[model samples]
Target chain A: MPYRYLEDIATADVAFEAWGKDLGELFAEAADATTNVMVEGLASIKRKETIDIELRNPELDILLYNFLNELVYLKDARRLLLRAYDITVEKEWPDFRLKAKVSGEAIDHARHRLKADVKAVTLHRLSVRETPEGWKATVVLDI
Target chain B: MRAQLAVPESIKKISDTVWEIPASYKPGMLVPARIYATEKLLKEMDAGVFDQVTNVACLPGIVNYALCMPDGHWGYGFPIGGVAAFDAERGVISPGGIGFDINCGMRLVLTNLTYEEVKPRLHELVDSLFYRIPTGVGSTGFIKLSFSEFEELVEQGSRWCLKKGLAWPEDLELTEERGCFAGADASKVSRKAVERGFDQVGTLGSGNHYCEIQVARPENIFDGNTARAFGFTVPDQVAVMFHCGSRGFGHQVATDYLQVFLDVMERKYGIKTLDRELACAPFNSPEGQAYFAAMKCAVNMAFANRQVILHRIREVFSNVFKKSPEALGMSMAYDVTHNTAKLEDHTINGRRTRLLVHRKGSTRAFGPGMEGIPERYRETGQPVIIGGSMETGSYLMAGLSTGAGAFYSTAHGSGRTMSRHQAKRTYRGEKLKRDMEARGIYVRSDTWGGLAEEAGAAYKNIDEVVEATELAGLSKRVVRLLPIGNIKG
Candidate 1:
């Protein structure tokens, strides 16, 4: 049961489910689906660039916010459209590191378009769970 | 989904215009619950807000409505959009209503330079503005206030800025209560609030706070030919708008007073509440007076904060355009608060009693020719600013006299429709930035996670929300603004 967007408000709970041989593929699929809800052409990104991210949250919900926020930061500072290619999420000794490959073309008025500018990841109705088949997380975004 | 609410036994819908939760509803309620939202929006409200609002209704010595505004949401305890008035004689004050950011509000600036004149320099202007204004979480400020000066600021609000040469005296004319709430006793504020506030004047705190550039609509312009017609011209002219509030000092004050209220709610007055987060002391009571004094301190601090930001903006324009701020036409349009409680004379039960009106997550929209309004624009009405998220456009409105029944208030921002968690899970930061850039909204932020949390989709539609406010006769739209650039903290 890979994660999927809910019919709720932009901030409403979204369901995600995916199973991969390793953590990298699982995260990549999750990232692809997440960005897909925002715009078209996630697969169009050439995976030309890679961003290194490290985030630690007492809860998985906060971790998700950090992950998404990093993507937002890169977009604003550098006018680049990014599609997550590969992702690695690890938890050990109370520290977590998430590394991923991302790629997008430089922003051009003729190309990319804007939809929503999210403010902050909220704590409302955030959950991450493991299933027999794979993993599922339900999160509400603060659009 | 429609709003799923857990209505406490204490609450009852008296009519379409009113909702009440009795004291017996939750055992600690000093007064009944009151809400002022339309049927449609009310039906869309979050259930947690109902619990929080009822919890506030049960506070000690609250008189009149333990009110909830149209955009109410589940907050710390009193609900983000909740408002309640305590009788000056026996009412109580709680920090929960004022929120962590005291007087967190919106300010609009109209320039002599129309949008067309500034359009060519839009990129330079946004970059300069972002650099000039300090922003982000735990951000510091350029102006630092001394202990005695801080006291004056707390007591005098924006007037303090005028005295310090940071503002135009005429600017105060367009501010609420002339930018000051009287009876602010600086001595009552906690040392922690004072310490935190002393150096953070003129800084923008993080989380949904922003400075934006917008263009006004043609028909809704109030100035007509007066030159202040929202400064919109064609598509290039830019009007500056920002939303901020008292910074860390305000948060500390709210924290301090909330603790005070909780401690004495039962012991000093035998008042109890279902939620300790809704703790309060009577307005006329010693505890209430103390809280009110501290709240005013935060209010004044916010005024000074905005004043300083204005100065910084002027400096930025001068540097970027190579002209004086005056030459750049960087003058303030108006400043108004969304989260605050004040004592005003309003006709209640057909009698004009000085009732305390709490406008949490609501703006004060006084009607045309109100005595309190400044003389220059008395015919038009008080300026009302409604800020939308970065991706969406914000609006400037004018108050209508018809709003007197609701204590002259209107909605603040588009209410949150999506939670932050859902946003991060659904949207990637880089992708969102690309989309925003394509729309011509240049954004500068510190954290990607923070940016994702504030995606514009998280909020209700601004146009719909503003229309609802008008339909409810809360405020009349004057000008609509589309964002060209933004700086978020």
Candidate 2:
């Protein structure tokens, strides 16, 4: 796993940090972390369905923030537990565009071991930064 | 491990239960920060509370002081239990101060039965409730609506329930804002928020949200007169209390506005906040007016959500006891919001002024004779429900005139002392459930891990938090409630 839960950050909610050698890997790890918070086992969420998502933002951090919230919105609106893959990010002079495919199955309580219901991704200590090794992002979820 | 931020040396004790950090503690602070807590609670507070509360003091147009209730804990933008009253004309409205779960609140309903009568069938009663009232993530409601109908429902709030025969006339009277917040323009809300919340009207969203069946013991009644006024006449009165909010609808509303405010707060307006989460817009600005209107839609949505849930509760009790809802004496005592920013009248520096008060993880405990309190509770003050951990107990309190200093705000719940990860590591949900059952409390949870994260030991001692509120003259304790049955989400 490229992401680890930060136990000491949020006293009532869940917080985690993810890292990767590139922005695509960093976004994927963060997406997985967000999904894992709501469902116990990642493998349990079989990829029976898939959706294509395209988003554009001038700022890289806001792009990641919006991407994570989109996943949350899908869970509530479509009842799908999704994980991102085939990720790609392109910086077009004034904006950054992200296009990816998210796959998972509709929520089945008997089959999936559910956990906390994440409300949204928060801006509290929210960050996406380029490190010497790669890229890193920290997120705090409102549960 | 996160290192604790040491208490600032400039902090001064104002009273046994009140502490103050002067404006000189930080630059650009509009007012001092006031914290209501005992010495022990003050010391036990997470370092984030101090940093966040002080950061709130620095926001533009804050009045008097930035206040935090005794149950304050570390949260995103404003510390949990944070309260700030801003000038309606000059101040700014930030989504962080109200929280993502717009109008996440508590509702207390009274019943005619006693604990002895309920004990024998508690399991059946709880199971029925857990099944009837959907729980956990991705759970939808029984009532379905089209996109346009959902828009109308958010605009009408709980009044929609009355038209559908889902709520009694008295339920609205007992609810805050009469179950409908004025200025809610459905047009201001986004289509995505409507889709997320339309089917979540009666759901109990996971993570600290629950619908519990509690009993008020004779020994726990502190103010018999006030307790009776709130309809706790039975010797071991049974009451149903639930904590929930607007669900995904409110989260989307908050998320949408947060980005809007972040975009315009500094560029369009000359406002700069220390924390990005505290991004805000001037109250009189176009962005601010739009967000406020949209926020009220979520507020109304939440009131409708709880109203529907209350109806389900009445249905479950009626079926279990083999009687009509009215025959079973199922009546709502009160419903109070914990997360909201409303325009209210308050005396600021001896002048009565209308202010937009933001309470995040706090409750409005309007005292005797205050406007908006129901006529039945006019003399005794508004009823405030403080939910505790399922394993411990909860409280029913009354607002005090003396709470005017904090804009009539008080603690909402037993604030968490440990993080969810820490609690999960310390206790097993299955074992905790078994232990609670052995102690005469029946609980049904959606997931064991979710149950483990909310262990009583993870939260502060409820008794002490209630004591601090009373000691600080914020609210008066009326009765303590111990859980007999609960449905955890």
Candidate 3:
């Protein structure tokens, strides 16, 4: 997994940090981290459905925030647990945009072993920066 | 202590139960971060509270001080239990401060039956409650409203419930905002929020959301007059308490606005904050007003949600006991929200100003004589309902005059001392359930994994937390109710 849990951020909320050689892997792994928080049985979710996510912002950090929050919205609004993979971030300067292809299936209460429901992706201490090695994002999920 | 949470050494002690982090602690802070906690409680607090509270103090036009109740814990933008009043003219409004669970609150309903009367039937009642009230993740509610009806509910709040015969007129009087928040704009609500809310009117969302049956202990009643006024008549009198919010409707509303504020804060309004989660626009600005209008819809949705649940509880009790709800004395005591931002007039420097008070993980503890409080409670003040862990007991208290000093807010609950991940690692849900059963407390929940995370040990002792609130003079303890039955989401 390219993403790992951050143990010390909060006592009630969950936190994680994801890194990749490029934005694609970074955002995808972040989604995985988010998905894993609510369901440990991520492997059981067959990708029978695909979702196209598009978001726009002038800032790289805000764009990352929106991308993660969109997944949370989908889970609550559409009853879908989406995982992003085909992710691309265009940092065309004064404007940053994200277009991603994500897949997951409808929530199955019997099949999907549920954990805490991630209410939303919060921007508190949310970090999206380009490191010398790659790109890194820090996320805190409100449960 | 973990390095991630360390209260800075510069915090100055103001009293035995008060501490202040002066603005000098941070360069741009407009006021100090005031904390109501004993030295020991402060030591047990996560150091992250220091940063979050100070960050709140830095918000533009924040008045007085950014205060945290004794039950303060680390949260996204505001330290949970955070209370801040912003000038309506220049201060900013951040959804982060109100929390994603908009108007998440506590509703206490008093019943004529005693603990002994309900103890034997506890298991059956819990089973019925669990079956009747949809809960857990993706728990679809039974009430399905058309979009137009849903829009009406959003705008009318508990009043809609009254019309549906789900609530009494008296019920509205006991609720904050009289069960209906003004300024809700259905047009401003997103369709996604409406869709999520459609079937979620009577649901209990997962993670700390629950419906518990409790009995007031006569010995625990500190103020008999106040307790009677709030409907607690005798020891062992049963009361139903549920902690829930606007469900996914509020979640989407908050999610949508957080993005809007992030874009508008810097680009259009020139506002700056330490964290993106603290994104906000000036309270009077177009974007801010729009968010507030939409937020009111969610607030009303939550009020209606609880009212509908209250109706379900009444039905369950009436069926189980073979009595009408009124004959069972199943009238509501009071309802108060922990997460909300509302426009209210408070005396500032002896002058009343309409300030937008944002309370997160904190309950409004309005003192006596506040017109916003229910008429029956106006003389005694608002009832501040604080929930405890399943094994531990909950509390009922009255907002004291001293509460006005802290923006009339008090601790919401026993703050978490350990993370859910930490508790799940050490606790087993089935084993905990057995343990609770051994102690005479019945536990019914959707999943063991979820139950494991809510282990009582994961939180600070509620007795100590409630004591802190009382001793801090923020609120006065009235009675303590021990849990006999619980239905968790």
Candidate 4:
């Protein structure tokens, strides 16, 4: 399950309904509901940090905006307070490969919580699907 | 994406600073359709910005009114707070009325250190302004230039950053057109806009550029009475606000002048358009004076890319306040521009003329003893800069002569209200960066899907859209700032 809020002007809103026995746990629960909409006790941090994400696109909505602009350039230039514990996908030929693992707490605010600075990931109204209950995507963020 | 056009039962409310629309609602218009909003911001518009300001009062030398300010939206073909002028000896000059980000502006510096000496190194001055500023979307900068010095920086902007020592020489007497724009013409630009502006000079591109760090809100510094008419004075001091434009060589000179005004619209003037994205030409065409001299060389390459990002923000406040970027006083409290197209002069039914205008996403303003501003702001008139996202709050208005049918436009930001795919299916870039760091705002970005597509509930209420563009006279407020730290791109 992945869900987030705030919509109108400087927007953000995400939804997930995953049955993920494929498409890599619905793209790792939609990148952990898009980094839990900017860090909020991703189940109390203990994933012990793994970080390794790679993306190339042909079009899965520009491979989900190059996998969320590489988790927003590792949370705004490497202050890294992550989520999305795992994702492995490969669809070569013009490209699409992502391998991810993330943890948190380097942007400590009595322990991770900072939000919205998003500035691009638009080709306006982008979408992705592989339905019958498995993968779904709808992206837009130019905050 | 469901508005096949509707809002105009011949509008009429003319008494809250106007709102007309008529000319029988739509038959190749030619005048009548004024807006300026505030009946609660005209019930937050979106009948496709009143069908693109009545399809811009059916173009072809339009004059009188097509206005629309209270920060209107639905852009691309004029409607981001649109404005139109046209009549330099019989009108027309649309590159969608100057938008593809040509002179996308805003600049305010002020400093003298307060906020208790910059709140114990505000996170090492926002991580040294996010590692010496260089922002998103194919971003690149470290001063590169060179293509005959980016053609003398599109022809001397910010006086070529104070002759390359990079700023300070009284920051070009507080910018505006002084940052260059004496009708720029770097040989009417284009070698693919000088190879996409050779290495993006001092970049901060991407949609809605930024760079903030403000304060002055102790009830608007006791109600701006002590910005001491510009020299400011304490009250948590520190200011730096930013917003960018004219990047990617102003989107390849508005896509090479909207394909040279659609190949000279109807073979040298037979004009016809209900929207080929409003591609226009006439105003004594030669491709509209070479798209107004390549839109004044994308407004002097966005005033020399914000005078080299204000010389890398005075070298990050002269290395985090150790002082010496002229004793860190910083300077330049004016540098407006809200998208381009100039010529100006005004007066209209009292005669004067010399129009052209444009404005897209608006700004000019003018007023108080005008002489086209800049003589230390000719008695406080043109400053205007609006920008308000990154957790809302921004204003600093000034222009007032009832803005003469908008040659003195206004409203430039705090418009959109969701639609970056409805703010990425409704928020959560880490819970909007942990609720803008628990309201002390400290964002830095390259992406969290571009920080959840900038979530301050994705805009509007820039104090009720600059109080309905200063109660429709189109510009008046004065000071209000607020943000504390940001750096998005």
**TM-score: model 2 vs. ground truth:** 0.99
TM-scores for every candidate against the unseen true structure: 0.74, 0.99, 0.96, 0.32
DockQ metric for all predictions:
0.07, 0.90, 0.64, 0.05
lDDT, residue A33, candidate 1: 56
Give per-residue CA lDDT, model 1, range B415-482, as digits (tens).
78777667777787778877998887777765565577678888877877777677767787767788
C-alpha lDDT of all candidate models, in order: 0.69, 0.93, 0.88, 0.71
Top of the candidates by TM-score: 2
Q: TM-score (chain A) of candidate 1?
A: 0.72
Best by lDDT: 2
**Higher DockQ: candidate 2 or 3?**
2
Q: Model 2, stretches more than 4 Å misplaced?
A: B1-5
> Given candidate 4, what's the lDDT at residue B60?
82
Interface RMSD of 1: 10.0
Predicted candidate 4 versus true structure: per-residue lDDT over B328-377, tens digit per residue: 77887888888787887788788897888888878888877888677766
The TM-score obtained for chain B by all candidates, in the order given, is 0.91, 0.99, 0.98, 0.38
> What is the C-alpha lDDT profile of model 2 across B180-276, one tens digit per residue?
9988998888888987888898898999999999999999999999999999998999999999999999999999999999999999999999999
User: Model 4 chain B: which ten-residue window has the lowest total lDDT?
Assistant: B1-10
